[model samples]
Target chain A: MEYAYYPGCTLKQSAFPLDRQSRKVLRALGHGLTEIRDWNCCGATSASKLDDFLEVAMPARNIGIAESAGFEEMLIPCSACYSKTVVAKTRMNRDPRLKQEINSELAHQVRGEIRVSSILEPLFDAARSRELGQRVSRQLSGVVAACYYGCMLTRFPLDVDLRDDAENPGFMEAVLEAAGGTSLDWQEKTFCCGASATVYDRETALDLMGRIFSDALARGANCLVTLCPVCQMNMDAYQEAYCSRLGRSRRLPVLFITELVGLALGLGYKELYLDRHFVDPAPLLREMERQQETEAAS
Target chain B: MQEQTAFQVSGDAARELSAEIAGRSEQPIASCYQCRRCAAGCPVGEATGYLTPDRLIRMVLLGDRKMALNNDLVWRCLSCYTCGTRCPNGIHTSRVTETLKQMAREERLEPLHPKTDSFHRSFVKTSLFWGRMNEVGLMAAYQARVLWSCLKRRDFREMRSEISSQTRFGLSLFRLGRLHPGWTVSRGRRELGRLAAKSGRHSR
Candidate 1:
């Protein structure tokens, strides 16, 4: 299967491993990600603050580009992009006047026609069908991860029908488990990771991250498996800030669900950019793989 | 400034804010039953003093426009939609808070959290220009705005700390390839500019 892909700016610029690994993992599962031609930013939360029309217009414009490129739907991996575009698409669908106004202003076809989906949808389906299990070259037996959803994927009060439950989403774990990994049931799965609040107030963002780290660590989760680039970036980049606050050093590397899937498919650290994280995931994965080897030998 | 009088007095003025919020953001500020579910679930409840989702709505409902537009919640809202997820009525408080933030700006009230204002401005401006945000460009632009703000206020101490903290964070990001520096403008830049004009974008 091939879907029109929107890597978003973050995935291309900041969250590099997420985009690369997701594409590779999907390829291993016999799928393709075709980048949307000349896509703009989804405007994230920033545009929404400035003006309502700008908020919807930015994402709606990207959808228009995707639709014009002959795609019925586009796959966005970045949670922030996914949520912004999803909400805008939903609002545009319900408000004909607003849709027509934006369409005419931007010279888009203005019909809210194309569908939008997060990349997780297909991964979850592949896992459920046991295709993921069949394709897994290396079972992540000892890799225990707390499946984190952040906020964007959790609640869609609008008409965008998502696969997982709002409160306790299971798709991340299911995908990991299918790849022979252990999923730790955690309470802070849907907790906020402070989002763009990180830019203005690092303290608030880090504090929220601390709470998430505390919970996951207390639950014996070796690492956090997340789909949202913001959650992954916060937990990975600012981990030192988290540890220094506690007056002790501990590193709980946050891994993207896609990267984990790539690992299960026997992809290397270089391929996943595992060395690029602040809190290195290489040592942890090595240890887990050794454990798996030992269990198999015994 | 029909809405300005409501901020100063009470009665019909207070009621107008509620209606204005409804008309502007199209959020149902009136449907709040004060179940406190939103408050309990709010991720920033501990961080914010008295700006729980329910209380924020209450401020608008009571026509406390001054407080509503300039509160901690309005400036610091994560827009994570945790409140909306838990709300019985499905009222997304983030949208209400966003509407309040824009309201504060149009009134030219000094933002209570000036750094957040800087972030919003930098983010929108670059995103509008490049059609996407470059991590390095966004941060540099934000710091420049913040430092400029501090320079005007003659807050030398804040300028020093801001520089040091940002440098440290930037160094760390650079090491991780998180600060990958490149930009690609959308092909429809012309259309985007027209959209901004039609939407009344606050800045160029």
Candidate 2:
């Protein structure tokens, strides 16, 4: 199963580990990812906040490029990119005049036939087909994960349609279960992490992030796994700050779903890029490894 | 302790704002029946004073353009869309907030949250210049903007503290290879520039 991949700006820099792990995990599952040629930024919340034309034009250019590359479906890993691209495509396809206007702004023509899908879609599909289970050499039996789906992944039910229940999604839980990990039931699964607010309004963003961390810890989650880069960055990088601010000493490791899946497939820590996380996940991974060894001996 | 105050209908601003919001989002503001469900779901509504999702729509209906535009809540919105998704009338409060932010910039209203506004501008400008987000460039530009404002207000202590705190985080990200001072140009930059220029014209 080959698809045109769109790894947005965050994945290239701040979220590079996500890109590496995603590619590794997909290849391990016998799927191929081909990047969309000459893709630009998806013009996230910033572009849409500033100008309407830019919001539509930026994502339309990437979609047009994908269509021109002879691909009917493009895989986007970042939730923000997926949401922005899907929203742009839906609006453009619905309005002929808007479509024409956007096309005039772009070098390539948007055929409006291409579909944009999240990386989770293919992984979930593989799980349903039992290919994922077949490839898992190591079962993450002892790892309890709180699957966090930030706003963009399932925000617009009518527009994106990525999940059945946008408010209370179980897609990630299913994928985690297939990987042999226990998915914890938590209320903050779909809560907002205040996203870019981390940069602008640190206090408020930290407050929001702290709430998520506290909830996951209270629910017996050893670590938090997420599909969105922004959520991962906020929860992982700011854990210390949140803990210190709240006078708490507990730390929770946040992992991308791809990394967690890669580990279950017997991929090494170095291969999964686990060391690069802000809050080290090494201690938790070692604990898991120790448990696996003892259980195997028993 | 409560006094009855009647707000006289101002000519056209409220009506124009409501019409423009309807035109952009395609949701009828009149259908909002003050259920406060949107506010209930909003994460930042309480934190943001006087601009809850329901109240924002109510203000728009009342044609209180000054109050809606002047409030800091417009800029503080996280655009999470929780309120919008849960709206019984299907009115997207997040989209309405976006429209309000754009209008506020056009009307040259002062942002209640200056740092957020600066970051938003820095993000777009960096995208426009580099065809991708240059994290280091964005922080540098944002710091310059903040420093200039601080100097203008004669707040030297704030300027120093802001620079130091930002530098601390920037250094960490840089050491982690998550940020670079130089440009990170993507393919088809020239085409992106052309498209951006054309879109700017259309937006104007």
Candidate 3:
């Protein structure tokens, strides 16, 4: 079980927890994730909105690198990176002329043979494996989590080929359930957190975050889980800002699915970087630890 | 309710605009019948009073090029694809928005949301320089741009509070080793630069 991992820019800087936990979980599952050597930014929304050529060229260059390295499958952890890379690959494969133009521009030629996939695909497969249930040292039955997919993971149904409904995805929930956790049915699972708009349009982003937090709370979720870095930042870091604006005191810890998976596998808190979250997940981890002890004693 | 004025499209401009969009997007805009299903699902459409996804499509179909290009909604779009995924007519509103945005940039049309424009520009500039995003550099440039705008509007208090809050949050991230003040250039920066320059020339 080996794949070339694309961590993208955010994972190295803002979303280190996602990067760390993802690596930890992969290693724990007996999988090897070799970082895509010398990868650049995926050019995300800004490049795509600004320049069509650069948008395709940026990701195409990285995919070309993966192809040149002889890796058939590349696993991208960040949803934005996954979306951008997958979209570029799909567009290039669809239009050979455009592909040739991009390849000519690139220093390395993109063969279009390598497959781009989200880290969730492999994680979900591992969860479905028979060994996953036996490896879960801690059952997270008491922790009710609302799985938030945000926009990129399942945005384009046909193009992305996600395993669940794009609007109401259940792949993350399925993975969580396999790790002995209860996944809450929440409406805001697929809603946008206003993304980069969080920087420019604070009010709208906060309003959107407020709606998501309230929905998760209303659905009786103890915490929120996300696969995208931006979503985690918006929900975790800005939770207090939105709460104060709405005049509410409630707070819900937001965790990356990687962190949650790492915890269920009996990884230590420090290794999972649980303290790095804006809204502390320590209390929740402690509660789960206490529950596990009581269950063992009973 | 306010009186609604009927929009009239010049025949030649309408045909040219329709042809141009068709040639670029390869999606038939004329197929859209003002169904408003895209509007119903769009998060920005619901949040903002203007520039609903349905209205954007209608404007393009009607050949209101100026209105379509000049509207603030073009830049404010999150590109979440909610409208695209839910469109009854198979029109991806976000893709339409992207095409309009690209046109807006090429035409040098002034954006209604200047901060978003600056952010996008700074983002591209940072990537081209480092072959990866320099988070610290991006924040510095963005904050400087935003602060200048705030000062021009005499919103000093707002600017002060925002900078302080962001700094505090940044410091926390810095403590956690999630942020750094230094640049980490990728090994393939030279190749990335070459690709970017080639793409830039191609677009022109």
Please give the CA lDDT of all the candidate structures.
0.84, 0.82, 0.82
Interface RMSD of 3: 2.3
Off by over 4 Å in 2: B1-8, B11-13, B180-182, B201-204
What TM-score fits each model?
A: 0.96, 0.95, 0.95
What DockQ does predicted model 2 obtain?
Answer: 0.58
Interface RMSD of 2: 2.4
DockQ per candidate, 2 decimals? 0.67, 0.58, 0.61
| TM-score (chain B only), all candidates | 0.90, 0.87, 0.84
How much does candidate 2 score in TM-score?
A: 0.95
DockQ of 3: 0.61
Question: Could you give candidate 1's per-residue lDDT for residues B119-162 as a string of tens digits?
Answer: 98899888887777888788889999999999999999999999
Q: How good is the docking of model 3, by CAPRI class?
A: medium
Proportion of native contacts in model 1?
0.77
Per-residue lDDT of candidate 2, residues B96-162 (tens digit): 8877888878878887788888888888777777777777777788888889999999999999889
Query: Comparing candidate 2 with candidate 3, which one achieves the higher DockQ?
Result: 3
Q: lDDT winner among the candidates?
A: 1
Q: What would the per-residue lDDT of candidate 2 be over residues A1-298, giving only the tens digit for each residue? A: 7788999888887888889888988898888889988788888888878777778777888999989989879999999999999988988887888889778766779988887899898889878888888889998877899999989988862355455488898888888889888999898888899999988888888888888888999999999999999999889878889899989897888999999899988899887878887888888888888888998999
The residue pairs found clashing in candidate 1 are: none
Q: Write the per-residue lDDT of candidate 1 for residues A159-221, one digit (tens) a residue.
A: 467778988899889899999899898889999988877777889988898899988988999
